[model samples]
Target: MPTGPAATAPRGDLWRFAALSGVYFAFIGYFNPYLPLWLSELGFGAFTIGALVAVQSATRVVAPYAWAWVADHTGRRIRLLRIASTAACLCGAGLLPTPGWIAPHAGYVGLVLFLMFMNTSAMMPMAEAALAQRVSTERGLDVGRYGRIRVWGSIGFIVTVVAFGFWFDRMGLRWFAPGVVLILFALVLACRQLPADKAADEGAPAAPPLRPVLAQRPVRWFFASAFFMVLAHMSLYAFFSLHLDALGYGRDAVGLLWAVSVVAEIGWFLVQGRWIGHGTLERWLAFACAVAALRFAATAAFGASLTVMLLAQAAHAITFAAHHSVCMAWITRHFPGRLRARGQALYTVLGYGLPGVLGGVAGGALSEAAGYAAVFWAAAAAGALAALAAWRVGQAAHKALSATES
Candidate 1:
């Protein structure tokens, strides 16, 4: 059947969003790879940077779900985007205005934490759930097709991260706050172009807004698995620059290593559907966790060989991205309306929040007390536990899904 004009519009909407994702990603990408580097540049010690990073993660733990709950009840997705993005710009821009105000020596930490709470954390979970819901239930939608659109975010991440690191070395971290503000403004414009969700029509049945998300077993397990995995996953990012710095790598080399990680992220997105075709989603997640276990191990052991470090970075595809895709896919397959958004929020809160907060602090303490080697060892240990958790979750999900069919 030929499509109507309205039906054709969402595909157009997605392309618009693809650009937004790229823009949104580009805004934050510079920091994702190099924030720790920046913290080091500003005469920061490891403990102080870790505390600052930990605060941001702590804010994310509660904030995503709170906003997601508001979105679910009000059915006000795009409105949240405008509010979230605008606030994010101001928050990031605040760093430039209010340096060293939080404490005598530790000001940027407070600034970044406020930014994550106000702006960046809410943007992606809301967008991810909205996009996933559209592609999941909408007739004629092809989910596998998302990879190409999402790849632009990776492209944005790589370009900005690699280039800006060089710029930071030359022009300095003074450029970070202002550069981030410009990129976020671009994201706000992109968000303005998104199609709004139509959940509030009078024809729809009345229901209580913001249904509790923990009612589902699959969701609980998925979030728990995400938490443990991300706890381990973030350790690498929160400290790998420091790890590399200790290992005799320069700022430029660290940027390229970070790029190598995201390149693997893009490659994983490219092959994920096919990779899952060859194995169960459970198998893919388990494989990724297992790779994470090794990736951390390699980070600890292979400080001298940049080649091994580069190869280890490639494991991000399996470790972070693949684990994320599996969780999102599970939500799409298992969750219904409103719950889907809430579930994504829960994932953000728990996955990035608790684990992230703890890992940043723990990775720092571990590095400070023992060394970078010990931090990766602890991260690997977390991954080992995550692998077990993933296997348990998969087995449990398989049984429950089968039981539901019967």
Candidate 2:
């Protein structure tokens, strides 16, 4: 059976992990909120923007698993991560619009976005797997401390969004691509420094097949819940900045608003190790789902109210942080040893990839038909569905335990 780490890591390892985490998510912070704004600035319509986002998400559905399969089979997990990170950094340069000659037409920009996201999509799963494996397979490393190291990513996000938001406030949105390239360059260096997986030192066996892990009932329900939970965020992710801009909130303020949500996410990451131990995973997931429902509803109803918007942003603690912690811990416990990388990839595909694709297409159409607010209303409904799925997950957990006991 799998287990959490039992001992503290050296300060050196902790700092290394923290730095890598920070650099990695710095790229995400830049990409997630601003990409659509950049697209809009380039003259893409709402539906076209959604289509581009959907294309990127569709690639994720294939990319992560393909990359993970390579890592698990080749036993070069860290090596693959480094290559992807480097290539992605190079691709970031393509997003910039050249003056006069090429102003980044829809087809060209969409292709670049697809390739860029595809290369970078597997980095998260690979990084998480590498760190978890490093902690578990080594002595004197505490698995419970993973969140503490990971929290730096949230900090990096805050800095990027706020600083870049401010910069873009003064400058134009055209600088967005250059800013992304700079951060991704830093990320490339960060990826090179991660420790190789000790389990693959030599004589390590290939990962066990994926069917057995997928066969578990809790895993299935968790993914079902997670798919909806992530799907609900599509409105916010694809258009939150645009929504704020449309409402007359300047870019600087929009960046700060994004920062506010991540600040809450950081706090949750700091305390999540303790929080995960307090309740059954099912209960934790259920609460997150319920909070997610309220969060999106608040966004739909009171998005113009700064007080209400901040409050909704704060709820990201439960919606993303708590939900994510539960998912990570569950995977750590069940998908031990050689299964770690593939398992993380599977989780990524289910929780993020599929949701991004479906939600992007649907949210784009809905926002165009009704309004941005309608997208959030639909998000609220998805959250409710996720909560119901979490309830089913809880039931399934109870039944499994009872069967094992009997």
Candidate 3:
């Protein structure tokens, strides 16, 4: 059901792009779970673990836009994507041997800064920017289709996570770094196959200034609500795996729970076209924010149970996937090609960089003091406020679009 980049691509680059995402995200699933796991095994606690993960999210505050500016103005999106991929591979490759040397002597604090932030961090947003070109700019492409191609990433996530869990059970975590390095190299290979965008490259149709469009009220609210949603969701990224591991869950089970969550994300990608087509942007945001509140609350309320945790995480479809598709469509409609990169950068800086950092820091403290339950309850509250912002945003978006049409 999913169209490849080339199908929409003037050159049939659809499958190639899909491969790119699949390989990249596969590496993410392959290694990310082990990041905190490694820290814990090395004798760090929840608070310290949180501090370590912060570097990764904090880097987005600067790097994505910095790289995106180059992609946009330089008309070197493909080349940049390739270079970034190669850099990421090199970074991941470097981490493979560091555990034997720097991890014990130099310490995880340094490695966290290096591995999470410096190496594997910038891969996703840059790749998303290029593949996102396939979506409908104005009306938007069918949302349901994404589930198919995106599912490969989920499959990759599931396979590696489960495999690593089993492998670690028998052998230990030493295998994680090597697996991650291999996956990054796979991504580089995939990037080599992606089709070039002549329009984005040849500088054919330039969109207007991003600053002017972003200056609008609804757009401002759009970002504010998005930031809250990401902030609310950050706890899962911060602590879900650690909590499970502490509760006596095996490595395999931990990976399975994560796999289930991504499956929900995959489902959302598949049906996004059908689901988002029915609602106005404001209503979509409202639903996603409301869902975010409930999901976090559910995690807080019955988090000790694996079933409850899986159910809550599965809400990733509405909370994350739907939220993203709507935001992408909104940007495409309101901003032009020239500034889309900047618009995305603003989205990254506000929604990702600032709130993500806050969420990581606060999640650590909450997990340490109030326990995981209270941490999730606060995230739920953040989602409620985000929903309110979306209500006002919906009203503004409708009014703005009506004015434009009239």
Candidate 4:
């Protein structure tokens, strides 16, 4: 956010931003798939693990916005990123067993996770806002440039998920907390490499109120679609590891399955610019949601078959990578300039936060009562709803465009 020379200087070193993204998501690759497994290793029940995972969602509901608002007003996103990363690293250390100090009890572990997630959750929104400013143009997001940079995150995730998957398999999950701390420490280092500029608009007029933007029909439908799509994905984020484990899949196989999805995701991100422009963003969102429906259904019904599981994982190219690109395009269009950070935060809150909570708590109960297959079935239903909502978003956008051109 630095003015003039300082602001322009960092543009030359885009890899710094890429590095930040890679390291952060690398942490995610391990944490999301393995955290529940670690808790289970510590003798926690499914419902308890679900509730603890919900802690991350609960913080996402408000923390990102709070951090973004401060960054928007102060134009110090990099500084905030450093603070969040450092704080999260510190809190992650609490997960380590230190005699009577850091017990693995539910109350103790839950609090540590809540604080860690609260800080870590803000990183992506702030980083995206900063990166988008660098890569976006008057026409829209520079898909090629953005894709080239963002692909590193996929690379990072794949590396860690596969490596840690094998590591935990060979050794044990007792080392999980230490791995988490190490990754978080790396995130702090990554943040230090980013440019230290503040946005030039620190003294500019206040950003337009967000309510009017929210009132637009297209915007409403867009959020609704995101909500359901991400809600459906919670099955993967919250329970995919446990699901495979329950079915007797080895930890190495679980990691390989996760890596397969990221490989597909990486392929899509590297070449998305070529295909993203072939269809409207809304149309793409609709397609992604439709694929999500199929993907989750396949995951639920045929999870026992390795071939079917591999095919389903491969669909991450469409279900996550493409959907993410389209959503970023939509958000960049809807909230330009000073509004960017808050816009990203709203997406996190509505799309991931609320649905994550519902998915974790409710999916836990459903999985406990009916089994993991039932949870994925419910996710498939959410995906179907998301497809319908995305279609409505396309309709609303077309109608609005027509009104304006007329």
For model 2, how does the per-residue alpha-carbon lDDT over 233-299 read when each residue is reduced to its tens digit? 8878887887787778888889989999999999988877566667877898899999999999999
Error of 4 at 271 (Å): 0.4
lDDT for each residue of candidate 1 in 191-263, tens digit (9 for 90 to 100): 8888776644223443244345466565566667778788887777688878888888877888888888889
Candidate 3: where are CA atoms >4 Å away? 1-7, 103-121, 205-207, 402-406
The whole-model lDDT of each prediction reads 0.73, 0.81, 0.72, 0.90
Which ten residues in a row are the worst by lDDT in model 3? 1-10
Which segments of candidate 4 are over 4 A away from where they belong? 1-12, 98-103
Question: Which has the better lDDT: candidate 2, or candidate 3?
Answer: 2
Model 3, global lDDT: 0.72
Q: In model 4, what lDDT does residue 186 have?
A: 100
Q: Give the candidate order by descending lDDT.
A: 4, 2, 1, 3
TM-score: model 1 vs. ground truth: 0.90
Who wins the TM-score comparison?
Answer: 4
